[model samples]
Target: MAQIGMEQIGVVERVWRYPIKSVGGESLRQADVDERGLVGDRVYAVRDARGKLGSGKNSRRFTRMDGLLHLSSRLLSDADEPVLLDVDGTAVPDANGFLRSYLNQDDVELAREGEISHFDELPVSVLTTATLDWVRAAVPDVPVDERRFRPNLLVRTPPGCPPFLEDGWPGRAARIGNVRLTFVRSCVRCVMVNADQPTLPHSSDVLRTIAAGHDNCLGTLATVAAPGAITVGDTVALESQDAL
Candidate 1:
């Protein structure tokens, strides 16, 4: 039965998990939600000699390594073994060996998540179609996609939902299918959103369009309050704490 105070904000349009960071992500019809967002998400990442992780942008925790976006990884088993793939979708036999050649660097290892979490801020990132609509209206000449935002959960709002609807979700809770999430804050995007993926051309205009009016924040971030499972077409119902 639906709760009296719950508001149905949207339906889950898509689910994604990037087994390897800064690389292409795998989409699924359903996914298991856990404390780390998704069961196999970001469990593996390419690391360099200096101990910085591979990413499209350079930072203390990440090193700007070109061509990482041209690659992706898929968890082959429950053990969390990742199968590296090229942009053409061919799986590489030797993961590390392929990384050396593809990235043109040595001392690179496809390492697993250590004590420090691989996520940029929160465990999960969420985006709504309403926000994408805003981006489309802002820069109709360029392309704007949820893949560019790299959200773990993509919510599909109704036709008239305003843009950035998730902005007001902080300090609130939402039930997405069997999973429960606590909204943390708006996701502050970085240069990685502008990186080229398999079919996406590299373009600065996407991020530029966001920064000009939205303070470089696009989606929202959250933590799994009740770990479970979610599927495409699942209803996302919000529970406002302030009203409770």
Candidate 2:
């Protein structure tokens, strides 16, 4: 067995899923993990009338993704209903309806083509509390929260480590019970980080600091090595691999 860190850490918090593409996201207490990613992560995405993939990268010219939010998930409540939330609160009918109201009909087309109903960029995204505190100390002016990074898993780890040190965590696999995740690449920050949580106005310079100090505040992207249910307070184990 490869030697791992001495301290143990558990998932403290989680947040923000892009149900569609550039709209908005919702916070979750717990979620399911599969090969594609967290179930219902980027399940639905919006596209223009011309069938082009509407994303913050290009469509920022015509539509402001920061102004809207899109979220979805397969995990349901005790009542067996979809857990949905809009910019307003935890009660939106569907992703399309949310976009229809948030963005005028002229903008939202037919749910975008080539978008998978269960597609997500990564299996899971994690941010360490230590990294958040470091950023807070480094940039006291900016408000750092789950909304800024939109991570699926927020772990409370030791302090003073380099931002997104998880990128270097290879051979080492993080386990939450039967579920295991392999650390992938460092997430690249973008304008989406500047968008406010709710109707709040966007804050400037936050992404700039992230880009300058940290590697765009993306922390790290992870792939599911083992699929299983994850909940808060579950013991997280880090097993080092020989790769490094």
Candidate 3:
């Protein structure tokens, strides 16, 4: 095996957690890292009668349901009571009722019965500011906020590094403070990225740009190799440089 060198790639710029699937996320200054991901991330999910998790990826109950993105969910009362806030920043007392009314579906239910997360792919989603900028340049007309991509950790890549460089990072391991993460696979782009978080409108150009530029993939899914606390400004280092 060729010997690899260790270098400071970047610092954790931001952290986010989505307590409920298909709902808005809460930004954080620090988070407890675990095998499942940042604690409380995707800990709950809205379920349909058929038990399908509510996700924009579902394309059945959640497609064109960008309205869910406009509402932010945060743990307020307790783990059992995640408060959903509206665009106006008003607290929603009845989460299921508000969701039912907004989704216009009566068969859906909020569930948090077990420890298993409702993640669509792997536990952790990692993105770099360099890649975010690349997507913005690819589709200048469309707004590209990290929220649209729903990444758990956003790293600011080293200066002068090329964009979308993480596309080649699958199977690599990243070390952030006491945590170690193994990059599992490239995250596939979907229509969810095209949905505007503020206006909840769908724009085809976002996904189109990713498809044309990077084969409909950006970011990466990762699993925890070692768990610890991760904070903003923590230095990130790639521990392994294996083939993608």
Candidate 4:
């Protein structure tokens, strides 16, 4: 048998779920894992009047997409109903309010899709604390918050392990207990990273820093290979199938 080495790093300190795209995300103490991904995850998205999906890409023209911010459920609580909040103290309960507050134009025409809220083209997104720290050092001017990256899983690993090294781990698999997830591609970031969480102003050089160091491909995207629940303290093990 060939010897395989695995390193156990820090635990998942937080779990965030963006119920609706560009609207806001809810933080959770714990979440159920399924084949599709995390339960109540990107299950809702914002759509324009034409029934087309709206994202920071095209919606950047409107400051709402850039000005407003959303976080995961893990960061919020039920007492804070209408979980989505803006920098100006405005809050919304459901999609309707979110559209109104964000779009700004009363007749912009918007709706929320409840059936499926997919993010770009990936099933799961992951990031690391070390990577964020590295980028912050590269560009002292940019404030790189996890909310900006909007990742599903944020793993904290050793200092020098490439931030998005998961890119090279493609075809291999990682396990958090019985749950297994396959690393796919790197997550491509956008102006959303520059947008302030509680303010409307935009910051530059955020993506530039990422491109400089961690642009291994884009960002980190993954998919669930086996269904099981994951938590903050769960230990993750990365294993290559060829060794088996």
What is the C-alpha lDDT profile of model 1 across 1-244, one tens digit per residue?
Answer: 5578789999999999899988888898889888778999988889999889998888889898898878877776554587889878899889899899888897898998999888889889899999988987987776768888889999999999999899999989999988999998999989987888777778898888889989999989999999999999999999867653
Write one digit per residue (lDDT tens) for candidate 2, span 151-194: 77777664555555566654467777567788777777777776
For candidate 3, lDDT tens digit of each residue in 1-244? 2226544678999999888877888888888998778888877777777767776665543434446777788875355657778878788888788878878999776788375547777999999999998877877777677987899999998778898767767778877888988888999988888776775356798888889888899899999989999999988877655422
RMSD of each: 1.4, 4.3, 3.4, 4.4
Assess every candidate by TM-score: 0.96, 0.76, 0.89, 0.78
lDDT of candidate 4 over 37-65, digit per residue (tens):
87766555555555555456564222234
lDDT of each: 0.87, 0.60, 0.80, 0.61
lDDT of 4 at 218: 45
Better of 2 and 3 by lDDT: 3
Q: Which ten residues in a row have the lowest lDDT in candidate 3?
A: 57-66
Clash number by candidate, in order? 0, 5, 0, 16
lDDT of 1 at 76: 64
**Which is the winner by lDDT between candidate 1 and candidate 4?**
1
TM-score (C-alpha) between model 4 and the true structure: 0.78
